[model samples]
Target: MAYYLGIDGGGTKTYALLTDEYGNVLGKGKSGNGNHQINVDIAANSIREATLSALSEAGLQLEDIRHAYLGLAGADREVDYMILHPIIRNIGFTNYTINCDTMIGLRAGTNHPYGISIICGTGTNSAGRNTQGEDYQCGGFSYMYGDFGGGGSLNIEVFRSVIRAWDGREQPTLLTDLLLQLLGYDAVEVMFNDFQDYGKQVPVDAVRLLFEAAAKEDVVAIEILNHQGVELGKSAVAVVNRLGMANDAFDVVLVGSLLTRGDRGWIRGPIEQALLTVAPHASVVTLTTEPVVGALWSAMEEDGLTISEEVHVRMRSFSDFELIK
Candidate 1:
């Protein structure tokens, strides 16, 4: 029996799955973030570790695999591809197909056939695959250029607001107190040195704390979510319009852990409403999928196998190592 492999490269965690050619489950593994924007060395190591771990769980040597397909988040552009392909090749797989994480999630969530997948986990993105199997994607740029509803953007918004409050230029909110408490300081300035030291620690996630404060209905916090929701809705609209997924099918899917959080309703719900207004033909719902399963579906597609209900259910039923929180 031949074996196939699939990987979902994420910002915080890399998920991998090993399955028989028939899509019967075998083994699964995971590693750290493979997002290029984070740390390239960490990204490569995550893929390598996750691949090797999957192989081991399957009780086979790495060389015994027939094909491996990796769906990584940041490999959309040329520079990202150029850097990733070589590292991936060096890992010594026989056949490897790579694309942005958004594309892979679409394949995973759609049973590896055709449909749209919206990743709304720690970050947010949407991808559509036509009946012909051609893929259309939107969003995944980091916080600087884009990244509306993502963790990074949320963090940036709250942190900047905190600074504004500290400078006496903006109204105070529960965020300032929450953040200061988190840092063991009465005032943000007391820890300015530790805050600016990005080399020692990443401060990007600070905004998530702000989101929590907003969830408490703090005035400043509520405004932050309102603003972020509008922005996120705008980004989602661009994707639905550009890809024409609204008319292709009446359905659009949402993926990612962001939806699992209660506060995300403020952001994602508005995006759905906005999408309907813009793309009245598009039907939106939370995606029910595990991308590891998507990898399996992708592997089957590569081998000219038709994905069916039986296969889809089995793949979706994959049980393995726990997702470490």
Candidate 2:
């Protein structure tokens, strides 16, 4: 009768799932902006709301859960754990495991101890775990930390390209019109004025237009996607080299919006080419499981459950709930 909880807390939203000991997804809850670096109170409240909603849907109380796992963004350092642990502890789960979101994204796709994981959402990062349980990471510290190729970064690049095109510094691009259309501006001049007057950050989701433009063979947009893919590949290769896993036949899970969204070939194709150049034996795969599912799987593992391939397949197939979309 035991149950488990899994949470994926991110910069834009939070997702929580409730599952039975047998891996059946019983309930799911979602909330907003749970990255602790932004605002701990907002993050904590989001986590609490998602947890309670999932618990209520599962017809279970907090005390009924045996264990929980939280995969969180902006939780890289020990200080981050120190700040986040208490937030969850206060949410009524005493037995919990917390780790960076990239780890769970990796675990969601494979059980291999040695593999690379590249996440490209609001931010980008890469991590690889060796057979000895040693971990190596690259590019999760933000742009200031020398990371690029996430949705946020790509969006920034798109705006810059549009600006350059408008000013005739760069070749004319469809992105100029596309960006204005999406932003509800009729002309580039207005966007230019606003961008200069007030530093308004573009929505990360607006990167979808880049995908749309690329689908139509927009040179600038496709170039941006390709560049991002190469950067992501470089990040993965760095982790693989750091862990000496280039020769290992390991999984490289691609997670996050830029990789998972529509017609991802513009991104995926280049990334695969770049990784294979360095790690010929590496098998690149898209992450199909939501991060919360990875957290739940880890919870079951921590609880001493022997998860078979059949169970893993079943868990992957259980896509009944929304994933904070």
Task: Tell me the whole-model lDDT of each prediction, alpha carbons only.
Answer: 0.72, 0.83
Best by lDDT: 2
Candidate of highest TM-score: 2
Shift of residue 158 alpha carbon in model 2, Å: 1.9
lDDT of 1 at 190: 61
Per-residue lDDT over 202-300 for candidate 1, one digit per residue giving the tens place of the 0 to 100 score: 255565675588678788887876766676677667766666556655455566655545555666667677877777766666656676677667776
In TM-score terms, candidate 1 sits at 0.80
Tens-place lDDT digits, model 2, residues 57-165: 8888888889888988887988998998888888777988888888888878886534778888777888888766678778788788787767777888888899899
Q: Give the count of colliding residue pairs in each prediction.
A: 7, 0
Model 1, clash count? 7
Query: Which pairs clash inside model 1?
Result: 72-101, 108-294, 118-255, 120-255, 121-256, 121-257, 155-207
